[model samples]
Every structure is written in C-alpha cells, then in structure tokens.
Target: MPPKKLSISRIRAESRVRSDDPDLNRSSSSNRARKRYRSVAAGSSSSNASRYAKRKRPPQPKLSARVLSILEDDMRETQVQNRFAPDLRAERQNVSYRPLTLTQKARRDGADFQVPTLASMCCSIVANCFDSLLPSRDNFDAAAAAAGGRSASSSTAKKPIKNSHTLKKTTSTRKRSKTRAFGAAPDSDGDQQDYVPSEDDTPATKASSRSTRSRRGAPGTASSISSPNQLLAGWTTSELHYLTRKTSEQLRLLSLAASFLLYKTLVEQAPQYLTNTIISTYFLPPILSSSAASSTASTAAKTHVWLPASIPLLSHDNSAAAFLVGHLTSAITAAREYRFTLSRATEEDIPLTVLPSRLSLAQPVSFALRSLQLHGLTRLQDATLARLFEAAEPGPQQQSILRLDTISLRGCIAIADRTVTAICRSTGSTLRYLNLDHTDITANSVSTIMTSSPDLQTLKLGYNEHLSD
Candidate 1:
C-alpha cells in the first residue's frame, strides 16, 4: 500500500488558526489550570483526596504472628492432655456429700423412755442443741414425775375403768342400781362411753390439783383420763428447751428435703416459694461457713445438716416449704444482739443456730417489706431491715435485690460476709436502684461490694464516709 506524507506547513497552519480563536485559547488555558489544581489538591493534607490518590493497607503485627503460632501448638497439647485427664465426673462425685436427715428428731420427740435416761445426758445435748429458748427434757420428766407416778402412757391406765363401766352398764337391774348409786350420768349416746376430763389444764392449777388429789387419795368421779400426749403439747420452760433441741436437727433436715423437692416441683408448679434471700441466708451460709466446710461427711451430720443439691437450688412452691423459708428468714432477722437485749444482760446466752432464735422480728420485717412495696422505703433497725431484704424473693431469674434503704444500723447489729456476697452477686445487674443510704457499711466493704456489683443505681455513700469506690 502507498503511504502519503503530511506537510509540516499544514500542522503549523492548524495550530495558528486554533490559537487565533479566543474561546478555544481560553478553554485550553482553563483546562491546563484545572489539571494543575487537581494535582496540587491530591498532594494536600485533605484526607479524602489523599485517600483517593493512595489506598491504605493495615500493617500486620510482627509479634502477633509468632504468638498465634505458639498458641496453636499449645492448644494441640491441651487437647491431647484433656483426653488423658482424670474424669471430672469422678472427682465431682467424690467431693459430693449428702446432707444429714431429720429422722432422729421425730424419733426422739416420739420416744417412750423405759429406763430413766439421765437428765444430765439429755441436758448436755439440750445446752447448745437449739438456737431458741426451749426447755430441757429434765424439766419435762420432772414435771411428769410430780404430776403422778405415771408416764406419758399413764392416761391409758383408765381404759380398764372405762371397760368396767361398759360391762356394768350392760348388766341386769342390780348393775343399773349400782351405776345409779355411783351417781353416773346416763350414757348420752347409750354406747356406754366413759367420761374423760380435758387435758388442757393450766400448769399451776394442774400442779395444785395433783397435790390436793395426792393428799386426799380420793379417786376422781370421772372414769376416763384424756391422753397425756395432748398435755405435752404446750410450751413450758422445760418443754421449750426439749423442743429447741429436737427442732434444730429436724428443721435442718426438713429444710434440705424441701429444697430438693423444690427442684422437682418447679417444672410443674408456679414459681412461688423459693426466694433468692432464703437460698443465700438460710441454705448457702452453712455450706460455705468454715464449720461446714472443714467437717467430714460423718462430722457434718453431727456438726451441721445436709441439703440435697440434686434438686434445683431454689424452689417456688408456695407450700409449707415456702413458709419454712419464711420462718428461716424471720429467724435470721431476729438473731440480732439489740433485738435480744436493749441493755446488756446476757452474753453467752445468745442462741446460735443456722437460723435465728427469736421469731418476733419477722412481724416487723413483714410489715416493713409490705410498706416497701407501696412506699418504696421502710424505716427499720438494721436487724429487721436485713431480714426484710432477706425475706424478699429473687426476681424471675432468681436474682435478689440489694436493699439498704432507710435502715439505721446500730453497732449491735451483725451481718455476715456470705449474706453480703449474695447481695452483691444477685443485685449486680440493674444495680442503679440500690439504696445503701445510712447503712453503716464501710468504704472498704462497699468497694468490695462494688467490685462484685458494678451497676449501682443509688448508693448513699455520704454517711458511709469510710467507703470510696
């Protein structure tokens, strides 16, 4: 193919014509200026323009690469070790202990003593057995001996007298005449049932009657005596002591059983009874205490009681078990020094149980908690205040509230560490509502509590000058 050469004169003539047109010259100069401005702007400190010109890539950490490689090796070793490690199931089972039962308590209460069990033996157990002011077995036995030479079985002695009356009433006219001469009231039902005196006699009156009857040696006109077991039901100083001893062991067992039963019942039952405070204050304390922690299974039975951990730790059954938890909470509240004594009278006499000795403080806390439900604040002494909080059940998730609102804590009141911990852990989540106002909790304790419970709603740290967190 033939190629044609362009003349230099032709290109020069076209450049001259373009340069002569004013708009074309202006547009060429303007376009050149725009290119220059864009180049300057791209090099400037404005991040968007610079980013568009040069893309940034993150720098890889030099140490991270090596560390990850080492971690991978360690993980492989861990997996291998885990395959040969001792079974967690075995270790956990070995550590597991069964709680003590309340069977012996019911048996002891129902015992029919044949040979005299020395009052000293019974009294020794009675001394620290309970956390209440119940009476001792010695006092009961003494009262029994003083009443008559009879025992708890003595009421049955009159059964033969009743039988004789029955036989006599069924006999001929001679028997009827004999019954009339004895001034026997006509058997109203005609079944010939013997008349029995009521056993609910006042202690002093009953004692006086016994003395008078003993001196006179005259048999009572009534042929039947009510069962003596009914007479033993009331609380005397002696009976109180005995009941205190018996109830301690029994109550502990029953409480554990109730907790176990609570687990099974929670599925089918409405969550009603088990409260966060009850589990912490009543059930968990002894388990965590040095006393229970240090003791062996055998010693645990003697020293403390066992609760079946198999069931859900908390139960919401509104049954008697729930009432039991309530009683326990009340007992813990009543166990304050000031509650027991307005002035110093007794020191060693303070009863020590898993629960409190006095049940009276419950009334005040119950009233206070009710007031809190309506008024959001209830004024109470530290002891009662502590109890009201203890009685309040946890939330739906079993979370308890940390309550210190409007409480006056005197030096006489004592709260345990376990209780404080329970409050801290349970109240951590929505803690902004806390009212530690006027509580004597120190700064150090408050800080410790805050470390556990991070979300605090309202904490009165002013009076607690010692606290700082």
Candidate 2:
C-alpha cells in the first residue's frame, strides 16, 4: 500500500483540532516540558562545571627535600614515643590502675566454670559409637568363636553323603557319647533332641530372664544420684537455679551469657519478687520470701508492703506500671483488710489511709490515715469518685467503713452540697475530724454532715463565706 500524504493546509487543520483535545495536549505538553527541563539542567550543570574548573586552586608549595628531611628528623626526635596513646594498658605513675578487689577475684573464679552444654552432647555420642565399633583383638576372637559354635550347633544334621558312609556311624557314635556324658537323652541318630526346647519355653521368657540378669549387674539404683556421670546434669540444674534467683539478675549481668533455652528456663523458674544476694557471704539463697518484693504477710500486710514498694516505681517508670495493672483493687482490698487485722491484733485504732489522692504514693501505716486529707477531689467526675468508694470495699471479715475517722476536704473548688452528702454517706458513722475549708459547700449540707457524723471531735467550717454563718 502506498503511503498516504496530507497537504500543508490539511496538516495545519489537523494540528488545530488536536490542540483543542485536552488529553492529547496534556500528554504531549508533559513530555515536552520534561525534555526542555532536562536540556536546561544539562546546560546549567555544564556551565557550573566549567566555571568551577576555571577557578581550580593552584598546587600548594612544598619544601625542598633537604628542609623536609630536616623537619621530619626534628619531629621524630621530639615525639616522646606518644606516651599517652590510645592503648588502654598505658599507665601513668601519678594515676595508678584500679586493682582487682576480693569481690572481683571471686567473680572471676565463679565465671571460670561452664555448664555441660547441649552442643557437646552430640560429640560425646559420636565418640562412644566409634569406640564401640573398634573392638580389641581378644574381644573379636571371643565373639568369633561364640558365633561360629552357635551357628554350627543350630544347623540340622543332613543325611550322610555316599562319600561319608563309612564315617557317618562314627560321627553319630561320638555325638551320642557327648550327649550321654551331659546326662540328657540323645536323639535316635545324632542327639539333636537334647538341644530342642519344649513348647512352654518361648523366646519372650528367655529375653525377660536376660534383662533381669543385666538389671542386677547395673551400676546405679534409684537412690544412687551421686555418680560422676550425673554431676554434669546436677551442676547444670544448680547453675540455672542460681541464674534465675533475683540476685543473679544483678550479679551475673557483668559476666555470664545465656543461650535462648537457658534464658527461657531461668525466666520460667525466677520468682516474681526481688531477692537479697549478699546474705551471710552467700550470693543468693533458694528463696527470699521475707524480702520486700515477696513478703509472706497476710493479704493486708502484703498490700502495705507491695504498695510502698510498687507505687514509686509506677510513678517514675512507665514500664513498671504493667506489673501493678490488676492489683489496684487488690491493694484497696488489702487496706480494708488491714483495718480488720489491726482491730483483732491490738486494742488501739491503727489509723489507715485508703488512696485519697490519685498522684500520692503508697506508704506504710504507722497509723492508717484515719484522717482522709484529699485535695481537688471535687474536680474529679462523679463516676470516678464513686468508683474510688467502690474500690475501698472491705473483705467479708471487715465490719467498719474504711477508717474515714477524719476527712479534710482542703482547697477543693468543685465540691457541692451533694458531694458532701456522698462523702458523709461513706464515712458518716465513724468521722471524728471534718475540715471543709475553701469549698463551695453551704450550711444546708453542713447540718446534714454534722447529723451523720455524730462522733466528730472537731469541725472547721471556715472560709465558706457563702454559708452566711
């Protein structure tokens, strides 16, 4: 087919029509713009490169060979051997190196011993197999003799060939004589009946007999754990126990390294609490139940211990907060229980404080904060305040409302008469000290509080100028 050609005017008309097409204009314009940009960039780069090349720095002047050699010689002479170089072993007389102390020496010695490991077990097994395969000459000879004798005796006697006709009678007579000497009856021809077993003598029974005999000769019994072969396993177990002890978490960090399996085993066995390592010169003990972290206190006393130990960590370390996530209720429960135990354990009212402030740390109860001193509690949502009340619920044995003997609502801007009513409802029966200073409460609610809190020792209704007192 001949190539079709368009006139110049026809081509101009087509170009104008295509220019009106937004798709074609957009696509072609982008490509043209890209090419123009590349060309401009190339030109600019070439010009910059030439400009920089023309302004190239001249070679720096060098000293004559004789001057250079003289200077280097002088430099070498004054070098002083670089006494304060990067080498760590370099020591100065004025600053003596730190000596290894008794503790460091003990640590070094402890680190010298290594556990029998999993990787070396394969080598031991292979070595044992190789030793078994290479038997000594005496053993080989004995085994060969036993095998040959057993095989020859196990075979059945065939009919005598024509060549052996003369000797067959002699052979049979010799076998008969041997069997008779042993006092067993001989077979009709060659005494094969003497070796044949009865129907009751099964292979299973013979195997059982052999096993029992071997067991009697075995080296170890159930109580015999003192063998050298067991030492490796026992040592490994002890080492793992030592590593998992909370003290090891601090001490072993300096020297000991652990594989994943060992690390996992240690974590699984480690206690949930801290332990004291340096007790009576021993590194760590089997357990530290008496330690601050793992106290054996009753639930209430444990809360007293746990709250004091954990609250600081929670305030300072975000990561430590996870350890106390589910224990908030338990802590409150313990506080409530503490009140009960104190009543039974002694005559005095050991004042206690349930957490009245969100940001305050837990502390030991010299006297429970029977005086609930809270700040800005009124700013908290009603639901949150109610939740706090709910959390303070006592155990089944507890009878009194949590020691709300004294409540000082100081500097609370958001409290109302209804809030005081709620507070009075919780602690109304036992309250002895009531301080409603700098609050929004009115005399109307004050009467209700006084009515509920019959045991109040002192009431400071000051700074509530709106009370019209």
Candidate 3:
C-alpha cells in the first residue's frame, strides 16, 4: 500500500472524471470525511473513553435514632429558654409593653380616632396624683382604729366571720415572693399604678396580735407606736376606694395619710415590694342640699367634714410601703428642681397632680404617684365614680393584673365600657384572675367577660352576688 502513491495531477484528473460519472460518484467518501472531522472536534476519540466514563454517586451519611432524639431535645430546650427569658431592662422598669401594632399606629396618629378611651390616661393621672401624697404615720393609725380594731371582737357579733382578722404568715410570704418576681420600677414620669406588698413572716399568732392592736381602738383613734413591720396588709381594689359621703373628717384624713405611707414604702424596696392599691372611699357633700332651703339667712358654721371611720380602702396587691418610698424619693428631687404651687381647695395640696411627661429615673431608683386626698370621690358620689369604671393595659415593665386576674364591672360607670373592651380584646381567653367583690355590674357584663374569656380560674365575687347572666 505504501508503494502505490499517485501524483496530485493524476488524482485531480480522476476526481473530475468521477464527478461526471454516476457509477463512480464520491458521495460516500465525502460523508465519511465529515463524520471523521465531527468526532475529532467533539473530543470523543477512542483514546479518551475510559477517562470520561460516568461515575456512581457517593452514599449519604445516615443519622442514628439516638442522635436524632438528642437533636430534638436540644431544639425544645432552646425554645423554652427563649420563651422564659424576660427582658431585664424593660420587664421591671416602666416601659410600654405593647409592641407597635398596626391598629395602634392608626389610632394614635389619626385625628378621627377619638372614641373616649381615657382609662389608661386616667390610671396614669390617678397614679401620679396618688404619688404626690406624703405618707404620714398618723393616717395609718387612725384608719386602723376606725376599721373597728383588727381584733375579732365586734358589737355586732352576729357576723363572727366578718370580724376575724387572723391571717397566715406563710401565705403572706408566698404572696410577696410572687409579687417580687413580677414587679418592676416605675418610670421617671411617676405614673406607675401596680403595687406588690411586703411579706411579714412572723408566727401567725404574733402577726394576728400586731394586726389586732393596730385596729383595736375607737374608729379614728390615733396611735404613735410603730406598727410591727409586717402589720400592713393588702386589700382588693374596691376596698381601697370605699369612700362614703357620710365619712368623718378624721377618717378621711387617716385614709389619705395611710395611702401616702404605703407609697413611700414601695419606692424604697423596688425589687422586693411594690403595690397597686385602689382607694375608692370618700364622703361627698350634696350638690343641692335640701336643708339649704330651710336655712334662715344666718349661715351655720361649716360642720366638720365627715370622713369614713371604718373605711376599708381596697387594693389589688400585698404591700404599698415599697411603692411609697419610690414616690418619696422622686418627689423630693422634683421639689428641689421645680416650684409647685397648690391651692388649698385643690387635690394638689395633698401632692396628687398630673404626672410629668419627662422623668429622670436613676439606676434602680424609680418613682410612683402619691395622692393623699380623694377630691370628688365620696360614698354617694360613689355612684358617680362607681359608674366611672375604667380598665387599661398597665404600662410597660408593669404586668397587667388583668392578665392574671378576672375583672367584673357590673354597676361601675358606663364610661368604663371602652377600657373594659380594650382589656378584653388584649387579654382574650387568658383572663384567669378576677375580683368583682361588690361591684354593681350587670349580668351582661359578667357574661360577656366570662364567655369571651375561658381561662378564668380565680374569681372574688363575694360581694358581687348580683352578677348573673
């Protein structure tokens, strides 16, 4: 084959002949050359076949059941830890607890969003006003005396249970512990409303004796002796505000003074003791006195204003002493920086004023509102203020008692409708603790609150026998 080489001119002559001759056509040879060129360009040459062969995929690592179970447990624990960890800075300090919500933004900045929901504002205002009151030892002694002495002895012995004042010290300590876990410092504005009481862990006998002595006197008798440190006890919100138009001046002064002291104590023991006390007692003079028509042109000397001798101001906590301390410290500082002028007739004279917009809280030190006098609140006017039931989500860093307690608003003020609605909407099915002791709420309110909330566990309706659906 190597000896059969042909010249270029001979090959060209043969190709020309083949092009015209059908029997000698070169189509097959030309196709073979095209295929050969394609194969070389594609890199599919026979020499590279082994190197380009397909490979099997690597197997995936298999996890054992034990390893999987461990992973799941770790995930669960992490979730729990995240949920339980409280925000230290915001939880115990006066901070807004509500996250920025779509509806709130619309309502807050919207000019047309007015529906007369003043509960939160009122609470803040009242709290500030109360904080202004200075705690006086004289007030506590007088109130204790007026409540007919803490001893079980009663002239109307028919209701033996009513006169009993014995309380378990361990129970009080437990209450204090729980409150300490929940309470935080008030903001600089001094608008905080929640208070937790201190625990007096003395023997039950000792504690009862102290309480009895504090109360054993003519309603309105004043005592100079320092009460046992654990003498202060908590009341329901309604009890704190049980004002009557027929109250004596001495009793009114005592109620105011005791409230002031409670505020002082709370402030001093921030992390340990705080209290949310509601004072609802007062004696209101008649706006239109029938006796005025019979008065001879001579004006009678003003009768000593009557105050409640046995006023049982209700509160929603354990002790208010720690709360009082916070307000005292802040007020002292505020008085130094600003000049406050109050009229004799105004509640401000008793230190109850609107809270300031700005606050200067320092570290663990915080402030609270102090109101020593009940201006318009009275027993007969109780119907008016009673009709003024209001509810609000407590400020940030503060826990809402509504979150943990049930609330009944039967005969309370209709004006509280919006506040109650707001609380219901926020808490929904989680409302478990409630105290509607002797309120005048309708069955409708009770049903609505209960039906809407399925989580209620503790309800104090002892005085609210009227509540029915």
Candidate 3 regions with alpha-carbon error over 4 angstroms: 1-430, 460-469
Counting clashing residue pairs in each candidate, in order, gives 16, 5, 81
TM-score rank order: 2, 3, 1
TM-score for each model: 0.20, 0.25, 0.20
- Model 2: lowest-lDDT 10 consecutive positions: 279-288
lDDT of 1 by residue, 1-469 (tens): 7888769998788776756667766657777899999988876858786786687644421322322343357453233223322223334465755533446445655665344246433433433332232333444654555456454458777665655556644322212222333454565444233333343334555667666556455454222222223334333545556666565454345433343343223312322223444333333322222234222111111112122211132211213233333443543343222223422334555444533333322222211111011110111123433343455435454324223222212111122233344455534443444434323354556666678655554554442333555
Return the number of clashes found in candidate 3.
Answer: 81
Instruction: State candidate 3's TM-score.
Output: 0.20
lDDT of 3 by residue, 1-469 (tens): 5788899999888766645677567468778999989988677665466455544334423333432343357454233222322123334368556555657867777976644345434433433433223222333454465464534456656654632366433433233122333355545223323433443435554545666656676354333343322223332223333422112232244333333433333322221222222221122111112233222112211112211101212111212322322332333343222222222224444433342212211111111111111211111122222211222233455433223233332222111223335545545456665544333344555656777678777655443333543
Residue 376 lDDT (model 1):
9
Regions more than 4 Å wrong, model 2:
1-330, 333-369, 376-379, 390-398
The CA lDDT of each predicted structure is 0.37, 0.43, 0.35
lDDT of 3 at 95: 58
Off by over 4 Å in 1: 1-141, 144-230, 233-250, 253-452, 455-469
